[model samples]
Target: MTPQNPNLARELSLLLALATLWGSSYTFIKIGVETIPPVTLIAARTLIAGAILLAVLRHRQVRLPSDRQTWRRFFLQACLNSVIPFTLIAWAEQSVDAGLAVILNSATPIFTFLLTVLITRHEQATTRKLFGVIAGLAGICLVIGVEAIGGLGESLMAQLAIIAATICYAGAAIFGKNFRGLDPAVPAAGSLISGAVILLPVSLVVDRPWELSPSAASILALLALSAFSTALAFAIYFRLVQTLGSVGTTSQAYLRVPIGVAIGIVFLGERLSSTAWIGLACVIAGVAAMTMPRRSEYRAAQSAGNR
Candidate 1:
């Protein structure tokens, strides 16, 4: 694919949409976790989202693969993508500030890039991508405010947990490439169903969810988190994984920072500092650098278009 490919623009737009869904998820989670235990909350989230996706599949007359090998891969994707990371972030959010979580989680593209260079060799570690990684990280620091780092050392374990979750997300993005041949919804639904299987048992054992009474607000927040953030977001996520490649897809991590700040300003009457405006520009530039076609591909595309 090249810069002239129309799908490139559409995929990047979907990438931004994915970032927006996930950016808002932090607010939902904060509210939901107030009355629900982390394990139970995440379990319910996977359950509801998985069920919804399955219903959509049924409505479309699509069937999940019954092969043991495919199901096994789904289980692995679930562990990396949802079960472990979701639980860690949920638990860590109890102690870690949201700013710290945003910064740490936004490191996914960096990790994904490194893993590709060192291990998978699945994608090129181009100069543009490296610049994107650095610029995006710097932009996140500015957008979230430099002062947010002051609380970093205070919540030692919680911060570490969030970092661990970020690592898991990177791994999941790389691993997700294995399902490129399947429809995006297949892996999205399969992984969530697998996540539900793993988490529901743990929720029963650890949280005893039946005895808990969650507030209406928390329940509503969980519902939104599950439906929009998990189900819809994952579907978009898998599609990007196929269309954009892992590093390109995870660029949404950087995009999420600005989107989160924009959401705050719009809905919560929060204001941005001058640095944040600069950061937003950096984010847009970085995403463009990372997602734009290579110069050679661009030249080739232009030549082909003229033919």
Candidate 2:
């Protein structure tokens, strides 16, 4: 398929990196929280990520959302994109597997596409995009296997919480679309700060972090989560969106699972059932079909124009 833009290949590469890096986050969070309380981990993650990004943006002479209105927009974006989803996923991880959580989180694109159309008159869904969405979910079903139903079992509440995480992701996608015109660093910094604002208070109240002493290793891991996984990764992502458009860049989630699963296996010693592998294939196929450019068609049109 022909890419929509000349720089699409480069954007895809960046998106791939973004996906792989983010995939590692599930493992990092899991390990870090072992030594630190989950709420406190999230709160620390947000603040550190926010501070580093804001400082770097300032160093680069990049101006962010200066006005109250823009800050508010960023605030809402953070709530949907980072704060809410991060909190839900962190909380849900206590009960769910990393692979299961990410597989479910992969629903973001489908929800993003639908939310885009419902929210914006211009971002209407096309047949290809719709099919991709349907096939993608079907793929997830295959990878996880029907056995997941039995595992999810009577713990319907936990399953619902994971689904709720995806819903938050969908909301974030819609909110992120509005960031098209802003500087990538602007929203990156702003949303993180917003996340910190909300998470800190809640974490302090619930975790009562003063009562629990976290180890140095967990603190280091949390720093990596903020620096490599959260802040830097987001910069690469928003930059890709600028080059490839949000729809194109968002497709990166397809690649995230394999990398995430592999990381889980190697670092966390995760073992997925055979049914889950098949499900993974389905998810990958659907996302690939949706994201790949129709190069043959673009070439034919180019030839016709030459004639």
Candidate 3:
């Protein structure tokens, strides 16, 4: 649950609202994919979201950043956040249940922590952080359990795909944190637009959305997926990043888990074992523990105050 605050409640409310928006999207995706192919669904979603963002940016005349360096940064950000993870998750969700897919996605921060340690020397991993990750991973394992007794059954590859997606999400998070100094809107728009350009042709070659039967409901769902979930989601996410630094902003992951579980139960009628419930609690606690400011950070703050 999002904690209440006087000044920050509005933002907390908005973050929770975004979580809900994303939470409900899994159901929409499940429905859309019934009649539509994953490639078509994703292509339509990405392009539509890109078009909407382009229109908004144009209306506001928010001149796109033209510097070569900014363009490079934008390109990498798009690859990490959209092109890679989006495709992996879209395909993975097709094989795995939505609830389980989200459980896997929650590993994004753990991957992010590992990636940051490798890529950024200053953001060294701490003992508590390391312990927290291990605990969180144990919690995830408990939720998924040692189902390996059942061979590649049907979803072995699918589960692996979701894990890959989480890894992509980790890379994206680190990329995002690195780009925090730039205009959030610039990279936000760039990512969608570039991603669409990258995926459009691939989608056509594979699913050929043109040949697929088109109907009003499917079209509307695709639109909502793009407009609300992809486009607006990024906009709100970037805003949160601007308002709250990386650590504070990522608190949304903890919130998204329960919301996803609730959505799964309400819409998909998915069941969660009591063990899974306990695992979920552990996951949240572990994440909270990992991300909370260390005593050293607070002590440094106090020293600055004294100075």
Candidate with top lDDT is: 1
- Tens digits of per-residue lDDT, candidate 1, 1-307, equal 1124335668888999999999887777777888999999999999999999999999999999999999999999999999999999889878765556777889999999999999998787889989998888888888888777677888899888888999999999999999968989999999999999999999999899989999999999899999999999999999888778899889998889877666666654655667998888888888888888776776765677578
lDDT of 2 by residue, 197-271 (tens): 988998889988888877887777788888988998877876665554455556667677767877887987876
Give the lowest summed-lDDT range of ten residues in model 2: 1-10
TM-score against truth, every candidate: 0.93, 0.86, 0.80
What is the Cα-based lDDT of residue 293 in candidate 1?
79
RMSD of 1: 2.5
Query: Scored by CA lDDT, what does every candidate get?
Result: 0.86, 0.73, 0.67
Against the true structure, whose TM-score is highest? 1
Regions more than 4 Å wrong, model 3: 1-18, 59-61, 134-153, 214-217, 239-251, 275-280, 294-307
